[model samples]
Target: MSHATRTRPARTSASARRTHTELLSVYLNDHLAGATAGTDRARYLARSCRGTDLGPTLEAIAGEIAKDRRSLTDLLRRLHIPARRYKVYAGWTAEKLGRLKANGRLVRRSPLSTVVELEMLRAGVTGKIACWEALRQLAESDERLDPAVLDDLLHRGHRQLHALEELHREQTAVTFHASGPQAPTPASRGTGAR
Candidate 1:
């Protein structure tokens, strides 16, 4: 048979293609869940920190996160992948549930609460960085992705992590090491004096 007339080597098997599609769907769904949760956390942090030293930074992060979420949606659309709405809903629900967690205080915002939240936000940003890196790796094989955009997102994620870490450090120090009111002595307590 002539070289041009010969049949090309077979591509991936139908079953293998289906498996790949399934795995890709699962991967995208998982990333969407995390992105949704990160969006929730960012908004919460921005609102909760309003009028405080961390407010502006949180607001900026929140805005960036919102944009990132939109970008993820766009990417899914570009790839013709339907997002799992259920997972998105669940992620938002989980974020709401997180807000109800009890701190040591009954009515006041706990310093520890901010500390833990900063850590969680930082971790989420870290995860975002990973997602961007993974997508970047696929850009060579997948024409739907843009490496430049992924690079920009990866840089933003790192910046977000740095800002969160700085805030976390400052808050941790203030919460744990700053001078504070000491407990009343026995004599003072007995006398009913603060």
Candidate 2:
């Protein structure tokens, strides 16, 4: 809202929190799913949080906007994943983030390599763990499994994070512009010289 608020930073070691922060960026962009949003980079940036770590700061920002986790997470159900700001990812441990990046778990060229797929795998892993535990409890003969609640939890973890996927498309579309070599500049095309 103000310059002072914009400059605020959360207090933690540069090394320790950077990974988590980048992880948060990955998570957020994943949550937004990278639709055109409102055509405002400022709006697309989202997360006008107060504290450090874009995650908590996002929560903080939501608070300023009169929204909390329950409210935001609720909206999360329908929103496309958000785009990760490369600058934020820059702060993380290079090796681990590189693994994440190169693995295409954060960003990638192919559809299968995107983070959403990884998160879905993670979700499936979590679901299997829970399903195993639920089966174990079922075997115990004391409790009954509610298919509805179990399905909800399973879906939460297994949900596809489409942010990176959308970002991939959005970025590829830009490559044809004057910025990247995918397209030629006016001078190179001889259009500007005439």
* The best candidate in terms of lDDT: 1
What is the RMSD, in Å, between candidate 2 and the native fold over all Cα?
20.2
Model 2 residue runs over 4 Å out of place are 1-146, 157-159, 162-164, 171-194
Instruction: For each candidate in turn, give its C-alpha RMSD to the true structure in angstroms.
Output: 6.7, 20.2
lDDT of all the models against the reference? 0.86, 0.35
| Predicted candidate 1 versus true structure: per-residue lDDT over 1-194, tens digit per residue | 67545433333466677787788788888889988998998898789889999899999999998999898888888778899999999888888898887668778888888898898889888988888898899888999999899899999989999999999999899888847678887877778546
Q: Residues 1-194, candidate 2, lDDT per residue (tens digit)?
A: 68656555443356556775466445544333221111111121233212322334223222322221232233334333244445224322331332343433344343333333334323323433354344334335423434444455445324322332344354345443455356675767866654
Off by over 4 Å in 1: 1-12, 178-194
